[model samples]
Target: MNEIAVKSNPRRQRLLQRVRMEIHAELEAARLQLQQRADYHPTWDYFLNLLMRPLAPDRLQAEVGPSGETFMQFGTV
Candidate 1:
């Protein structure tokens, strides 16, 4: 490849790396802010738990049992 092409590739790669780093930093900041909000607000923690509850294994199994037995239906209740 020509020298200009080679130089341009590395410059483009460096720009991509910087952009990725900036995005990573922004995500980290957002995650930290969410964690801070969750920590400071008991209601936030409870709401997160509520959001996650339906995905819980026992909840899923109880809501829609894995087997024919009715036992699974009572697991989460």
Candidate 2:
């Protein structure tokens, strides 16, 4: 099938490529920021513990099951 080819102008092609590159760079930057935010939560907790010791509460106790003899630890680190 020898279909007639539609020629793309070089200037437009360059412009499109430039736009795509910019979008890709922005996406990568956003991904990095999200990763940093995800990792910050745990470290933030540790820092709060160190900086706000008196404000923090102690560990909690959980109710036992039907056996009524099994207690479980329940609280954030």
Candidate 3:
């Protein structure tokens, strides 16, 4: 469980490097596909926004009120 031991092991290092490479490759593929197909770009944008929402300071502030209560409003059909 030690971080130093995990990084020092040759097998673990290889496994970690392989995993990082695989993730990078997949992201690149997705980017290429998104660029070639413009129709799904909105969907991709929505997905990215959702993924990054938690990290946006303005979004976080808007979602949580001064009393520390979280609220979301939806429009009626």
Candidate 4:
């Protein structure tokens, strides 16, 4: 396991989670723009919310789950 995984430090974990969400948002935004979808805002908005959400002790990583009301679903939920 990685050192981060082994130690499970709360502060480091929160920082990692924040960085991960940012990356997800960035990649999803790029993909949506690449696909040339007209209505990418709400999807973009969703990832933005994910990026801004506060860290919870029992936080779960984003997944490729079934989509929300938005037409285009991201690979990372």
| 1-77 per-residue lDDT for model 3 (tens digits) | 35536657877777767776776676667666775885766667767545445433344354775589976755556
TM-score between model 4 and native: 0.38
Q: Weakest 10 consecutive residues, lDDT, candidate 4? A: 51-60
Of 1 and 3, the candidate ranking higher by lDDT = 3
- RMSD in Å for model 1: 14.1
Find the candidate with the highest TM-score and give its number: 3
Compute the lDDT of residue 65 as modeled in candidate 4. 40
TM-score of each: 0.39, 0.39, 0.41, 0.38
Q: For model 1, what is the error of residue 75's alpha carbon versus the real structure, in angstroms, after optimal superposition?
A: 38
Instruction: Return the TM-score for candidate 3, rounded to 2 decimals.
Output: 0.41
Backbone clashes, each candidate: 0, 0, 0, 0
What is the C-alpha local distance difference test score of candidate 3? 0.61
Candidate whose lDDT is highest: 3
lDDT of 2 by residue, 1-77 (tens): 12223346666666657776776666556545654774566545555443333222322334455587765764568
lDDT of 4 by residue, 1-77 (tens): 25566566887777788888787677667655644766555556666555444233233554344464433334564
Error of 2 at 50 (Å): 37
Clashes of 4: 0
User: TM-score of model 2 relative to the true fold?
Assistant: 0.39
Please identify model 3 stretches exceeding 4 Å from their true place: 1-5, 39-77
lDDT of 4 at 53: 42
